[model samples]
Target chain A: MTAKLELRNVTKAYGKTTVIKNLSLLVEEGEFFVILGPSGTGKSTLLKLIVGIEQPTSGQVLIDGKDVTAMPPNRRNLAMVFQNYALYPNMNVFNNIAFPLKMHHSGNITQKVREVAEKLNISEILGKRVNQISGGQQQRVALARAMVRNPAMFLLDEPLSNLDARVRFSARSELKRLQQDLKQTFVFVTHDQKEAEALGDRVAVLNQGQFQQIAPYKELYEEPATAWVGDFVGDFPMNFVDGKGFRPEWANIGSGPYSIIIDSSESFGDIYYVFGRTESGEHIVLKSPKLLSIGSQLKFSVTRFKEFRDTPQSTVGNV
Target chain B: MVSEYNNPRNRKFYFIIAIIFVIVTLIPMYVLIIIAFAVPSQTVAAYYPPLFPSQFTLSNFIGAFSGYSSILQAAFIKSLITATIVGALAVALGFHASYGLSKMSNRMSALIISVLFFSTMIPSLTIAIPISVSFLKLGLYDSALGLALAQELVVLPMTVFMITGTLQSLPKQLELQARVDGAGFMQSLYTVILPLAKPGIFAAFLLSWMMSWDEFTFAVILSPVHPTLPILIYIDSTARGNILFASAFALLVTIPVIIITLVLSKFIKGNYLTSGVTG
Candidate 1:
């Protein structure tokens, strides 16, 4: 099957600043692809380039195998949910959601709006102004607006970043479920690795306008293609020690080559994270099922280690 | 003393300042009212003006309204028509121009906006003669439409600058979202931008109308024959020395502005006018 969205050698620059440098991506149909990156990494710019909100300095953006690089945003047939949930503050929830349908001159717009609102579970607040709703509800209204059009692909730019932590956690699962049920191409961009892991079928770790690695969360965690990717994709991330990388969970109290003095330990339910310093003064964390007290010296061994070349890109994958 | 004044507990100081402000503003209007109703005998009897009307006579108002009723009526209609047209054109042009300027690069937009602000600083009298001569040659000398377009020269710069601040304050993503949600450029402008900018636009409209309604140089030079309220009032008071009639007309002219300000003051923010100029 052809990819729903494709960017070929897209290079975006403004005067002296090059935001995205020679980037390319292909999001297959019915896949939830997340672009995970730190801020100013050109993740949002990539979405803009795809949606035709901003033209790439050099690129050919393809939608369903058709070149739409020269086309305007409306003709591209893609819906974007912005980072700030850019719902029309002047319009009520109903009009805000129904705006796309009205623009296309869709028949039975009210009925269609009702259906989308029902799906998003925002039917009750349809008459309230956008500002009158909570941030989470405003987010749903934005989603409903995008979904009402039934576009070929969805370009979401950090749609859940504004929600509270409790809401964000639930919204992540809800978003994943929605994508699973709809099975449309979704290209979600966010800086949060946890969000990307939760919602992405495959997450691309982007940094400084380049894709460091793109793979499933498990693969990205277990087999990072670059040292930067290894350090970026996990909760505790990966700690670099003596020209090698390893996850905290991979090291535990056992017979090993290195010994460390435990600085402290914290417990979260079934697991304990023991933070310590190695003999060479490298900070390391060991995740263990058993707890260890502070100031206790323990020997630890890594089951596996990711060896990386000494470069800014930190090319990885040698075990 | 300064400390005492600055203290939050100083209710007496605030009351004194309030009384001073009310007196300062109301005194002129009170005097105008007293003179407007002064009978012919009272005017000739005293060399100095009376604090109160010695005798309130309806004849001054009757003479003012009936003698120059047609001229007043014509002036009233013309001023209303001119202000409304100027207000509408200024707002429409300002909205589009501000939106366009908002999309420009920072250096370019700032340069252009600086030029606009600079143009407003040049006195209207400097260009009044040239504009009047050109209007005469163009056969636009004494028409309300021509007057309105001329008034736009004064009003558009301020309106555009103010509306630009408002447009800058709005998030760019709203328009981008509108475009991705299937709106073309024009569609996004009207549906998303214009509606979102309603308060600022209305404020711009009110300011334009106020400017046009009170505009003297353009009205006096451009339409000397078809006088607007300000022109007629000026001529009546200064040239003809009809203080009573002019006071009544001046009072009449102020009513709409006062009403508009009172009704729409919340939308007309001082910060909205100057917020994004430097930023």
Candidate 2:
């Protein structure tokens, strides 16, 4: 019931500037995947590429082993929910929902429109114009419009961002339930980490057009593949220590005056930095919340710390 | 200082201005209506001795409508047909052109739009000879269709630019949603762009039609044989020595347009002012 979507080292450039670098990720059949990032992080560009509204400068996009790199959005058989819920203003609710069926050479437009409207719980609004509807109802119409087409892949770019908070939460849950019930491949993009965590089966943490990490939400949040990913995935993202080290420091773990034991595998140095617990109840801000009695002084290695782009003065009571 | 709390003072100030404005504009209309009922000789001199007509009769209006052969009648019909057709065509043509212009890259489109506006300042005096000669060469001379076409050409750029401006201001998400919903080009335009641009379309058509109906120099130069209402009034005034007849004729020609504008005034917005007709 679900389709497979794969992006192989996709690159996008506009004139002299490139918005999306060589980026790749995959959404297996029936998986709800999300590309999560900050505002100008090329997340929407990736969604546009997949939806075929945009073409990659290099590499390819594939769905179910078929190449669709050069296809127009109309030929891609993928539906997208735009951020602003683009319903036809000239059309009433029924015609707006029926538009997809009409576009794709379907005969039973009425039946399909009715079905989608009923499923989305917007049947009552079928007679009304788009401007007359509420935001959440408009969102449902957009969703229904995208769904009515029976497309292979669904590309949603901040689909629920326009909704109020309570509506957003419910819409997300409903979207997830719908995706599961339909068992279709869904590639959703959002700047909100919580939305990604709640909706995506696999989350791709992107920053500055680069795929910093891609894994199931748990692994991406708990064990980030890159520093950027670590900083981006969590609720209050993983704090970073304003320091560095090499293998030389870690090789002589206890040899230094301030000895803190850390798993030195990822720390590309010989005792540059470490995470170890101390006598106090505080955990190392850099290190995981593991209780390691490294000594009285090296307690949690709680040193000069700040969040990403945080001011030093703010760390006073922030500790 | 609580200066804004003086409601009585504000009302008095506004009332005075309103009275002044009403008197300034309405006094002329009252004089004209009175002249419209006077004898031809009295129509001019006694028509406006600052109020009542010294000698009252409907002969001036009846004579204006009939004594001028069927020329005035033909001119009135010509102007009506031309204005209505021109307004409709200008608006219809504006829709597609504006859509394409608005959806294209913003910077390039903006430059193109600036150039279009710059061309609007082109003096009608300069273009008149060229337009007339071209129409003659193209075999569209002295025809109602030709007159309508000329009027459309005059109004098209502004209408198209206005509608395009409206379309640009519309949120892009609406177009995208229509596309995602499986609407093709026309469907998307009708459903999304068209509905959102109602105010612009209404304003553009009414304004363009008004311009076409009352335009004097263009109608005089291009289609003197098939003159519009404005040109006909000018001809009558020049042939005879009655500015009163000209004024009454001018007022007659202006009534339909005024009715249209007044009725549509409520809905005519920036885009409607610049784009196409409602239908």
Considering every candidate listed, which one attains the maximal TM-score?
1
| Candidate 2 global Cα RMSD | 8.2
The residue-by-residue lDDT of candidate 1 on B1-279, one tens digit each, is 577777876877798899999999999887777667777556535787556666887676788899899999999999999999999999989999999998887688778978877756778787777888898899988899999998888789889888887888787888898899899999999988887677788889999999999999888888899899999988998899888788788888888889988887876643432211111
C-alpha positional error of residue B55 in candidate 1 after TM-score superposition, expressed in Å: 5.0
Docking class of 2: acceptable
The residue-by-residue lDDT of candidate 2 on A85-151, one tens digit each, is 6666656788877777877888888888888888999999999977777888988988888888798
Docking class of 1: acceptable
Chain A only: give the TM-score of model 2.
Answer: 0.77
Clashes of each: 0, 22
Question: Candidate 1 residues A33-78, lDDT tens each?
Answer: 9998888788898999999999989989999889999999998878
TM-score each candidate: 0.91, 0.80
TM-score of 1: 0.91
Give the Cα-based TM-score of candidate 2 against the true structure: 0.80
lDDT (0-100) at residue A67 of candidate 2? 95
